[model samples]
Target: MAITSAGIGSGLDINSLVTQLVAAEAQAPTARLDRRQSDLQLRLSAYGQLKSSLSSLSSSLGNLKNFSTFRSYTATSSDSDVFTASSSGKVSKASYDVNVTALAKNHQLSTDPTLAGAQFTDVTDTLSTGTLTFKFGTTTYDSGTDVYTGFVQNPERAAATVTITDSSLEGVRNAINEADIGVTASLIFDGTNYRLSVSSDDTGADNSLEITVADDDGFTNDGSGLSLLSFNGTDNDLLQNEAGVNAGLTLNGIAITSSSNTVASAIDGVSLNLKTLGSASLNVDTDKTKVKTAITAFVASYNAFIGAVNQLTAYNPDTNTAGELNGDGVTRSITSNIQRLLSNPVGVLGSDFTILAEAGITTNPADGRLVINDTTLDKQLNDNFDKFITLFSAYGETTDIYTNFVSSTDDTTVGNYAVNITTLASRGDLVGSAAANLTITGGSNDVITLDIDGVSASVTLSAGTYTAAELVTELKTKINDNTDFSNAGISVDVTESAGVLSLVSRSYGSSSLVDITGGNGKTDLVGAAATSTAGVDVAGTIGGIAATGKGQLLTGTGVTSGLIVEITGATLGDRGSIDFKRGYAEQLGNYVDSLLASDGFFESSTSSLKGRLEDIADERTALADRLNLIETRLRSQFGALDALIAQLQNTSSFLQQQLSALPQIGGSNSR
Candidate 1:
């Protein structure tokens, strides 16, 4: 920009010359960089398209991998008001005539029917402070001995109880609620006197209340004060409706009884919730619409994926346009692998159905997308859905195995198991002497802690004088009534003849162990034996090799892996060998999942493409920097030329002025 006249002295345009030189230098390199950047951008866009296409394909495969995708059962009830029925695809096409008999109800008892219309003077009044004993069923006690007879008792209920801190009619209800004894206590009144009422939490015949009075004030159902709340079998002081009964229903003329109105076991994979008493015909059939929808969706996804890939890889010479990823190796590999998977049959051996083509799904020869024939698919589902389910889902073959085969979902490996029962599983039990000679000085001093497996619970005995048989009966009730012990499946049994006391586990597995630790007064009843006995584990062999045992399940460990099965019945010899077969859907789903999961083939392909794009960007940046240096050098040379031309022009002017001053007639005049 500074004043310069290089052309004035040299008789040439110096600025124009420099500008032309720089333009020539930039022209080839700039074009090359532009083409390289455009290609890199196109490749990135192509990869993006590929990623989108793969995601769509993967999403479609998800439906195939689902276990319930093959379920085709539809259930309809003739009388929806009585009960609504629903079923899964596992249910066979059948019909059942269901008739509701009687619904389940909870045991409800109230104070004498005559006293229902009475009003209490004070609801918060404390009547007595004693142990509120809730004994259920007819389990007798022999006070002549020191401990319980330990014989068969009724099925244990939530017979747990709490100390009688408050004895008001309302206080009693609150205490019963806090005890959580699977029963509810409330007061119902019609304005005269408040009458106490007790109800069971669940609707079942076994759940009933038997309140016995044993307080500190020597109260033992004397019909005075808090004794009004006590009621035994012989006592008729309290009157109410009959005990609760289980719900009764007839399925296909077969009788069924359930503790709740909602019955699921009556039909496989079907739930029947009964309302009013009525008869209804339940029909179950295939849900063809849902199956068709899933199939169509998968087909669409496959088409979309293939279509996107084609757009990127296709080259059209006539149109004079090329695809973004034309001739790209990574894109070609992705397309080829997917095409190979689609073309090949899945699970080629031991299967009647092996590929999508076998299931009436075929590829279009032109576009390489999937297509389905609805009529053929409908026929297959109508014929036998189970076979269709096996065609796509992974299935296990259990020949003659016992011990209730739960399931094996951890790993997928075709396996075989040779069964062997070294010893039958057993429960842990503790037997004690008869209750004919037991002694109890203080009930509070007899606190015992019982642990089933690892679940521990504590219970304290009543603080009153008790006969030997009574004390033993109370101990049995205490142990059976504890929520933790009962939930852990620990029960009590007595033998009056042998006077044997024993503690046992309900389940026949190692996880069902039992332990009992007693303090002071409690120790004297069980012979001061505070010890633990472990439950037994099933012993078996899998695949002709010793298999590791966990409770009742036997799984392959050393020689083989991923082989698992359950054993219940303890036979001396082999139960049966299990064979697993992978169906078409199972094979395809696994393969597709491999392509979509982290570290899968598609992931590697994408990562490689992304890496290349990064390298291209770096190359572009380096070229730009080199071009910048070239431009700077050209500018510098031009700047020097301009300055030199200005200097020469100034010299020419001074020389001309000096000549004009020395010569007489050499100057020329111009207007």
Candidate 2:
């Protein structure tokens, strides 16, 4: 068929054509390899997507499983009859008569009376006398000798002049308030004149103020206008005269108290309904219905998980193929573990409780779907709720099935991760050493060591090695004997198990170092016999003080002082303490309850879902990067092949031209 190569002018040459075809055939295997790699990558990407989806579904199922139901009630009350209910949703017909009595109030008068129009010329002068005082509810200010300067001045006294020289009037006010006297002082501005007035810091008759004047000529006891008996009740009461005034109330059959006003107070062992009277008949079965709702929710969540797992494994007619997790080991393992966990019975009150077929949930062999028998479940919930709780919840001494389902460590493939954090560097306690030149008096005659910064001093006593308890006892004796050590606020304690000697300062607030070393020439037993060779040679000021005074005690700054640790580094890689500045954990728990009551739990769950979506977005970015790289490689390889094909075509054409131009050997013979 190719014999007409000589007739077709400038046609392709046979040999060049054959060579080009053979080169093209050799590249076919490489193309196949590229396609196979692409397929593998696609499969891996599908697997990743499936895994991510499953994880998200699992998280959602976990939340559904944790869903809970709470009961709330309203109350109604009458003056004669009090009603209480064990449960709400139904009107309690039973009623009882009740009687309430108000509590009595206690009152008292102030002891240190101040006459009206009494003025202070100088608060510091009065304070210097070592007795400037006030009273509260007949209780005299006992700390009169420790009084600082005050700022209160009588406005009624025209000739009385008060001039505060050292501190502001506010400072004086703070001092008086801190003293907790019955009278509160305030500054009054009348145009150009500034006057200070003292008022009773209490309510009712209990917090009346009486002023008496002494030595101050301008002060007067005026009985007529704004008399000395003037007792104005303002601010907090100095005397708490109201005794248990804030009592809870449960009126009629309803709780109408100032506090929780719930049905719990309406009747003994009963909660009351405090609602507007109405003819609508309340259904008592509503409470039972709520229990039914909870059961339904639990079943729904359990079934949903089962359905999801089944979808991930079983084949379907619509999809015409097995699920994403078909034949997957992880999926199978999870299913098997969950099934075993649910089926296993837990010991409780002399009986084994389980949540499998007995809970009205039966597994279908075909699709692994759980079918719920509602009738059976309702009966079980109604008859044996406590037992049901025991089976599901970790109530009493029984282990909970729910907790085990989520947190059990038996399955390692998927478990919650716990992270631990620790502070990097912390210093051990400092110790002191004994030297022959330095007199070591006070405390026991045992070897002691001291640490300054990173340096250590070891002073061995003449006695043999002693236990930590013995060392502590000896150290205490030495401390008691030496007045300087005791007065210097230094304390010594030894830990036997760790063989650690600790030196603590009594003055914890002070930032100073205690000097353990005595003077150079002191001839104590420690000073004469102590040798520096065995202990750390602290030459300069020992414990922040230079060696001074012969036979006198060496005094220095106190020891419990150092540079405060300022945390500065990379973002703290640990969860810090969440200390409530003004509240407690119980308050926080109540806050959480309030949040949950206000639908904040749903918001939090949605936020968590949004976070998961962001993770999916990150995965998509990674997939995009991989896709780009694959495309780049594929383009480069394909382009090189196209260029080779073009070159082959050109070579074939050139060979054809050369053959056409070749001399014809048998043309005449053919003619």
User: Which candidate number maximizes TM-score?
Assistant: 1
Per-residue lDDT value at 630 in model 1:
72
For model 2, how does the per-residue alpha-carbon lDDT over 545-648 read when each residue is reduced to its tens digit?
A: 23221111111122211111122222223323210011111122233233334364324544554555565556556655755565555545545555566677
TM-score (C-alpha) between model 2 and the true structure:
0.34
Q: Model 1 over residues 1-671: C-alpha lDDT tens digits?
A: 76646465456676677668767876787687678767767777777777777777667666555546665578889999998987863477788999999887776766653432223555664556676566444322222331222222134432355677776777777888888767788877747556778876777554555666666678555555556666554433454444656789999999999767778787887888888898999988777667667667777877887898889888898998878888888678767877776676544444555566666788888988888887777776667555555455555556673644344453646544555667666666555543323444555466767766668778776555544444556666777777877775666543233333456666666876666665655455555543456778777776677877777777766544555667776475767766555554455556666776889865776687577768767876877687678767865776676667778888999999998777466446522
lDDT per model vs. reference: 0.65, 0.36
Backbone clashes, each candidate: 30, 42
Cα error, candidate 1, residue 445 (Å)? 8.1
Question: In terms of TM-score, how similar is model 1 to the real structure?
Answer: 0.77
Angstrom error at residue 458, model 1: 5.9
